[model samples]
Target chain A: MAGLTDNANAGAGRTVISVDAMGSDRGPATVVAGIDRSARKNPDIGFILHGPRDELERLVERRKSLRDRCEIRHAPDVVSMEDKPSQVARNGKGTSMWSALESVREGEADVCVSCGNTGALMMLSVLRLRKLPGVNRPAIAVLWPARSEQEFNIMLDVGADIRADENDLLQYALMGASYARNGMEIAHPRVGLLNVGTEEHKGRAELKLAHDLIAENAENANFDFVGFVEGSDIPGDTADVIVTDGFTGNIAIKTGEGTAKLIGALLREAFKFSPLSRLAALLALTSLRRLNKRIDPRRVNGGVFLGLNGTVVKSHGSADATGVSAAVKLAFKLGRSSFSEKLAARVASAVRVPQDDETSADSNGTTK
Target chain B: MAGLTDNANAGAGRTVISVDAMGSDRGPATVVAGIDRSARKNPDIGFILHGPRDELERLVERRKSLRDRCEIRHAPDVVSMEDKPSQVARNGKGTSMWSALESVREGEADVCVSCGNTGALMMLSVLRLRKLPGVNRPAIAVLWPARSEQEFNIMLDVGADIRADENDLLQYALMGASYARNGMEIAHPRVGLLNVGTEEHKGRAELKLAHDLIAENAENANFDFVGFVEGSDIPGDTADVIVTDGFTGNIAIKTGEGTAKLIGALLREAFKFSPLSRLAALLALTSLRRLNKRIDPRRVNGGVFLGLNGTVVKSHGSADATGVSAAVKLAFKLGRSSFSEKLAARVASAVRVPQDDETSADSNGTTK
Candidate 1:
């Protein structure tokens, strides 16, 4: 991909977000309209939108606020959702995804946001920004609707990779804690290692080692390391940050989403069971709307990638303008706080424990 | 522990279920009461109740139905919920769990039911009944609430052990399919191997190997083997039997349970949010009751231990009379159908694919 030069005319204090305006299910028009929405709401933010120049310009021209706040970078190629990550990494030159991330690499944008393929996005980010010095693997952090007043708990390594060693888990703890502190403004986020049981001796060998390692560094990591937590604690108030390998984390997340949707459908069916029940549902419309708003998946649509040198926020592929705007808003917040830099530092500082030490003690046993 | 000896007095046509009448949170009274409830509804069923002779006799005397249907076997010890499996294995003699399972081993009962510590029950079951010949690992199967009119999907290895190789997974498929066929009465039930994705290339290495083995054995196993399934399919109707490693299966089950409870609580809070909404709640009470009954965990509370020489049903530790009765009902159904013999045949037939093939090929590659 041709590098989009940094915005030389922009003021030093201004924040510019790079957006990959292609590959989303809603198409480029919706992506541009979403940028328009964000731009209108916050005049202080600017964008370097990556896509075909004529197509993006037409959409941006439809909104005066977006045209004024956005600068288009022409990249003719697009990464389709079905494209394999390996295929994209090797031959994805001039694609909008590569260009958008390039802007971040070249210091043209403070953050990068895309509503494209998740695996492809992660691959691109790792290929472009690279893992932070001490980080062995990157992780994806998601916000789950939780029981606390905050209404959200952060879970990490959702699908970055299917594996995590003991040291990787410790790094996820520190990185997730840092994200929670910066993103959620929690002073000292409580971190829990997800396990089969709360008992110390339960689960696989690595979880045990990870449990001990997290506890050992809890003070320096600036988080409370709750010994162990079960899957039920994911949406509970027992922990603010839940850490697990991507494979288990991904399964838990999908299972939770599937269960929620099933219940919601069942609830709707119940409300429509009879004329009297329909009347009751009509009467409870306001309360039901309030409840729906609280549990809406679209409201928490972005999964931020951590452990990379740059911040990349991945919106749901099927996100509408509202969801796209939400992702943009998250990217803007992290950009303002320099979240990527802080996360890199947090991971690097926690890497003082040598990886060889694990091999020497032969404590590197895995669940497999 | 003294053997209760074979029940020479058992009627030729009756199905006997050994019941551990102690250790449940509701105590022996509830166990006897549950028996009374089942006896009133199921005339063909008889029970061999295990507990202290005096305490159980008093409870049984309260119900004339239970007095005639139950045979008391004095077991003065109980397995506490906190007892470790290893500890229980060595010194579990004279305990109600032990005697209840022993009844099955001795052919005094067709099946055994207990509402005690799960780990302890599993330990006792394995020690007394032993794994079926040709079976390498035992599994626990639970019925999940599903989209099918059947109202449930059977999932296995909920937490039997934290590991399963390709052969073990293939065994789970056959065992779980046999369960669905005999217990749920689904002829040629569809079996699915749970993974992170539906794509053939998407998950762990063992999953891929297991996938091939299941597909290869589907016809002989007497089930249609779907290629791959995600966590979402657990509640969907895509597959009748979902099989995975114990680690993933355990996490998914607990996550689903926790998510269901969380949503239920949130819905209640929503209904009580305001006076007007509270009025709506009162009007919707009947529909809500119907909805609650459909999703009630108590209605489907038993976890059937598979691959064992005898069928053992583990009810929830905190099960009340209703939950215990549900478990007893399941036990009765399985006992009446001679489920153990059918499952053992199914597993033994599938075991013709030798465990040594996997060891020689070293196809034990895991996702990690």
Candidate 2:
């Protein structure tokens, strides 16, 4: 356990992250600016930047702080937004995204961060790092800004795959709990199975089976299974880790984001309704700005890929410098904590006993 | 077609709706108040209120408009919120929910309105009214306030059943289109299958099959099939009707509602942050009020159960007079337009051709 955990930073004095400086909508300049911002704030963090050597050298040279703390890796190719995952998996050897994951795989960096295509990044990370021993399918866990004291809840399987059987959902619960324990520093995360309703008898059969299975092993898994929760609980403080299949999680996250965007647009429109409203908006600008900063997506801009041997944080493709800096900060935090090894140990220790299988099968039959 | 379509208000001076005056959190008083509000606006509407005759008569007598428009029924039993669907199906004969649905089944009313447990209401409706021919499952359609010119897009399978095969989703498209045409007055509605991604190749296998099936029959069904849509499209103008399985639709709608509520609360908190912000809030109160009214859930309070022989409008259990009145207005609109007959005709005509079975199987094989 010690060797595996220490492999990330080993004898290093500072945490190092490999960043994929390609496929971001804002280009590598924004990525460099973001790294500069993050480096200015966190002097203990270093970066192994992966991109075209000449372009990255010039970009890093513009910032004295980044130039002092960053290493450049020349990966001339990039995975485009339109690149198919299968194509990238087969022919993505020299791409920046692939190189970033390779650094993590080779233990040169603690973790990897990318603002590239999500599908391509996931595929490359899975291909390079491989899934954990007992993990059926990998999941992408995003920290959602919610009403909890921690201000965020870890929601998993956001878009790694569209399907999750009962067993897969149980794995999400264990993996998400490990993430919360390390990423958010929660001792015993309260895990909730996302469903249509909070009733024990509601939702799909798979969900019910997952619910029972999660409950049966919550004690052994070192987490509190809070039965089932509805969509409202995602933003509320009902759970620390909300687990579901990729399809529903993806839809729910997008829906919440879309609603937030809609409300923001409406707020602007409302403030500009008339001269008096415009004056009011000007007067309340400070309060509105504070509110906006508190709920900004950039503040929680990294999606951690779980159930893999190494860690990969996927930042928003169109993230600006501040958003990119936030993602970098997240990667640094996870790296310093050796999140990958802790997660791996947690998953490994959470072995489902054979007797539990008999009980799970019986519950499945009843639920079905 | 003519006979069935004209049966709603055939030779009658007014369209009558049967009301289940039970299981509402606010009790019969709110139901009577809602009826009074709707009756005041629409003189051509009548109601057969189901509940204890003495209690309903007393409540109706409080309002002169309701006294004239409502005819009280002697239903002594009310369906409790905790009643299971199976229990309701076995022995719900004397319940107000049963009586209200019976009115629609017996042709005494154009539609039925209830503020009871949604699951129980759907079960009773399906048992009493039966599914329309060719319809594999019934779905509940709700009007989602969106960025469209219509201001609301119809979304189906909000919480009917948790599962939907390819055939069931195609039926949702047809049923949702019919509801939009009659309820929103759209000549031809645009239908989109809700998926994790907008790409035709993304999302679940059944969704891909449903997409092809919907596309192949969009012309025949007199609607446009707009490939796949994400959760954002539910509140966008891209599609007039968003279709998905019950599980996803229910979660999305609840998630949207929860997000809206959270934002609304946060806006209030922001406004009351300081004395200056409080002043600004007061100054901009008018504009804020207008914005609130535009997005108020009470205005779009009804969920119309589709794919059944008779229409059942399910209002929020905790609805006040305004929300209940909005639901009543929806029921009246569907009743006036003979929505049930049009929906049945639409589903009956958009038949899945037998030869397409081979193509569907082959596509499923490849996609799966």
Candidate 3:
């Protein structure tokens, strides 16, 4: 993992992470605090923090651990949450988000982390690092807390693009599997196509086509195709990877989050209803804290952008210090493992077959 | 509300519910037990139980409360969970699901309740009772437990039709608002178009068009338009009615349910971890029970089919007695309110303007 780092500033055993210190809901101090936390825990990690130089300098100076580990890149402009992706793509030259992506593009960082507008970050990443060869649509893959042995499952296209045809879904399946393999270290990930039902005849026409395509490439792609899975299977043990179009994937994740939040709020209200319950809550505090740690959204905060030339982890814009640290941790892990290169190779190999067949048929009048 | 019942067998104050005693995961006995529970609580509720004569008769006989309140309708065939929607629509004549719908169609029951296959039941309902005027696509509206004052919010197109166009989404907004009004008694319900994000430009093209259409019809349809809402808004105070296509809605609801179940499992596991937690669990039993009742999926068990000629409530196939009783309660509420008729009237009024304008333009060449 150490040998894979090509960044000159990343010393002998260190992994350099590019971070946009602006655009997070909590501001640059929280981001610096987060990196400080990561720096305190891991000595081999370094940061290329992008933001207004003077502001970031003061913030970093206050955190002793980040003082030697962080280097600030002067990017005076900040991308607001409301910025349009197209506008950002066309004219986002001096922004912190743009500067952060440039570090990865220039091989000065193993991975990039940002808590900016998702659309803007995606737009900037695609514009700067570019899509991998043979990759049509890049997808955002998040690790969903699950009941599986691994404790999480990978779901993709969680809002990279609104629509995905058969080919795009096939790419998601491969990319998701690659993520599960590299990010989660699963030897052979089981991929499931998200549908209304597990039945063959269920859901849209494109889903049916995608089903066949995913199944056809599963073995070659080094994953087991679990056929169709419903929304329930996203957190279930049915598969390691759940693949779907951005529209459905985005809604499913947010719905899951909302439901969890609602239940958590209800549980708190329930415990506060009476004196006896409040006493019980005190006695159960430790158990509750343990459960909270296991399911805390902050613990699994990053949504990795797959099918990109460089690894980019998009942290929740509203993330706190813990959440930002979690995102940085995920970025560091992927960086150390050279996840982006492996993902590009996997996608290119899986998509190469049909193109090769077309070329062969065109040249020799024979199908492979 | 009591004066709305048109069923002849229904007592002067009774609302008659047609129930398919077959197709549920638990068999006829559980269905009988469920109706008996409802019968014991609501004296003004009656049932037209549909299933095989001998099996249903014996089951109904075991439940003393149901002896006088329930009337058996002989239908030997059963609609299994695996039955295809098209197959059932074409050749499901003597099935209990078919007979249950017949009672509603023939005005012998105010509302129909079924635990059959969702697709099959929807297909059969559309085939039997038919779609109401101006409804291009029918939807299934479910009451999702929320943090709102109403305690639950309504979400539509929850697997009635996998696809909904702009006009179809407009119809859903109308139907969902009507359901919230008639069923939940929420006057001027706020309706939101479910999307990947709350932003106007975040989702698919259809969503953008649907957003405009829903906003345009909000005043005429007698509902407040909250514009675009993310999946998080489904269980939120932002909107009383959430409108989306069946594909997205189906996944969202299932994902929500799955997440709730997972959290519930983890909470239980957390409580069972140590002896101290076990003691805490015992002390917190009442509070936990209160919390359970508030978020229990079974408590809000029915998914009401909207935009149809008659009201039909689809209970979860695996519903236990409590779940079934909850569904019956919902059906009774809609039945007593003449929800189907009110929904039809609401949809007709909202859609009439455009057609009237087109007609006037064709005849006299002037815009309204």
Candidate 4:
């Protein structure tokens, strides 16, 4: 056990990264390629790829140098994409994704990045790493697809916490603001609550209440409150931070994601329509490449599950090598940042110990 | 008042649409163009161009046939995009948008369309139309950008009814299903609850509970239960009908909207960047065109605010003449169909009598 674990700890000292080799669209090949590519980019980092030993061995056969820089930790079972997080966590003893998460939990890895069932990864991380004491829920804080000067909006509650109230939203605002300040390393991050309209009274009762709470909190709020933002602001970089409930935030983020894919599909078709359009597309080539790079989802691959005790980054489940590589780099940057521990402790201290809305554990917490 | 009202209802027999002659983006010219185009396309439908009579008349001077088809209703005030709904609704006497809505409320016109402040429009509509007796909330149901065999997915609570519960979600599901069935004229619309995952254990407690309610209701539920769908599914047509709380549904729809814009921008850049890429784009043009048609947001320009007593279709705020025309056509189709009356009655009847989940105007009812 010691020998095996030690081998897994080859990631020690160097920014040790544990990749869920079995996770994602292309599996270990992509993960391995990404890890190797990223390792080459940053010589200071090493990795432990968690998956079936035979598969990793086969993929790594020709990559001898990469093998030296990385080690494989055998995780016998593979948790599937469709498995229930709780069910998987409860029964998944040696699943690759599980072991990758366990590596971080046990301090064997400095950062854990996985392109697996995001919710499952989240559940496992919470069960193993423990939630920061005060924060009731961990949110999925993301970079709002903004175009404004403050392009780095840290929008939160993208489904990690479901029934968030005014206080929960405040925590979200604070956590997101902290991330903007620390993660993006922006100073005096500007925060806005995502509303239907710019008016304070424009949203639902909770949004109104949250608006008031946020407004009052903003007087003493850790970050700068830039008032409210609308859906259009998500991509406009209207503010450095945007906050909303997990349900709304999740929908908004995914909508952005799916839309991006849809547009890509559309543009390809648009160019094929007529020779004139074809000429126009050809003529506009230079500017288009820059635009493509600007919106490349792969460039910003890892989405952090904020308010956790440590760094737990989720890459796209269907990510290719570029996306996984970006996730690795992101995890590295976040793992070494003081924001994780500082914000975790601050959030723990800052969290208002309000009464739980409902004591009865939601039996219907899962979707059928 | 009687004389003015009589003049207003002069075209009652004609399919005259009251258009808010104000442009949300580049000002009134675009709106005028849109209305003129609508009047031209649907000769059977008349146009009530509501705005500054002078500006509208001035804009209408050139179009000989459009001048006759679209008569200006002469509204003095315009609703600013930034104004609060509560304030704006009260402050505006005969704002073009307000006046247009009034036409619908008064039944002076068959329908009205606005590319104005959606918040104000919703508020005014609810105030004027009054929600159905059993209806606690109204929702905006729109077509998703994803490709579907059904051609589109109906998503509700776009931005209205933000803080919704299980009952509200259930109503949304039923209404969305009905809209798909009647509005799109599909049969046995597949209803899906949008969530983080499809597993029974995946969404928020309310959704999980809703899923069970839907599944249970499924045994007797009016629509086909397609279970839970993720963000990706919205674009994939995973279900014919997708239901969620207003808050989430709004964000999801908007995210898709903004993201499509962002990606469109990216693809334009990609096709223009270099020579080889440009040629490749030319080759890929055919596929791109097919993709565009598949995801044309304008093709389904109007989003029906379901659960309303009448078909109230909201077009994209920046919709031009073609979009508004499409919306009018949609409203007419819905109005003519047994959709609104039948759907409302079905949903109202189909709703579980809230045994223990008495989420009605009365929630104090005892649980089983």
TM of each candidate vs. truth: 0.93, 0.93, 0.92, 0.80
Per-model chain A TM: 0.92, 0.92, 0.92, 0.87
Residues A1-368 of candidate 4: C-alpha lDDT, one tens digit per residue? 22332254366567778788986877678888888788778877878888988778777665644655677888988777888788987997789988888888777776788888877888988888787776777788766556656444567878886668877887788788777766677777788898876766567777778776666545333567777787767886668788888877776777677767656665656665777767756655555667766777788787788777677888888888888889898788776675577777656544433222122114321211
Q: Candidate 1 docking category?
A: medium
User: Which 10-residue window of candidate 1 chain A scores lowest in summed lDDT?
Assistant: A1-10
Best by TM-score: 1
lDDT for model 3: 0.88
Pitting candidate 1 against candidate 3, the one with the higher lDDT is: 3
i-RMS for every candidate: 0.9, 1.0, 0.6, 4.4
* Residue-level lDDT tens digits of model 2 in B1-368: 22222233322578899999998999989998998899899889988889987787767776766545677667899898989889988988998999999889998899999999999999889889999999989999998878888878899898798899999999999999888889889998999999988888888889889998888777666788888999998988899999999999988988888878877777788889999999988988987887787788899999999989989999999999999999999999999999999888778766756234454435442332
Which 10 residues in a row give candidate 4 chain A its minimum summed lDDT?
Answer: A359-368
Candidate numbers sorted by DockQ from highest down: 3, 1, 2, 4
Question: DockQ for each of the predicted structures, in order?
Answer: 0.66, 0.62, 0.79, 0.33
Candidate 3 docks at the CAPRI level of: medium
Alpha-carbon lDDT, every model: 0.85, 0.86, 0.88, 0.72
Model 3, residue A156: displacement in angstroms? 0.8
Candidate 1 A-chain TM? 0.92
RMSD of 4: 8.0
lDDT of candidate 1 at residue A62, scale 0 to 100: 67
lDDT of 4 by residue, B1-368 (tens): 22322144336455666678773665678777766666566666666778887777777776655644566777889887777789976887678887887776776666667778777888877877677656788888888765677667888877787677787887787778778877787777788898876778766778887887676554333578889888877877668888888767776776677767666665656666677767766766665667666777777888676666555667777776667667767765665564657876767665545343334325432221
Candidate 3 residue-wise lDDT, B149-169, digit = tens: 989999988888899999999
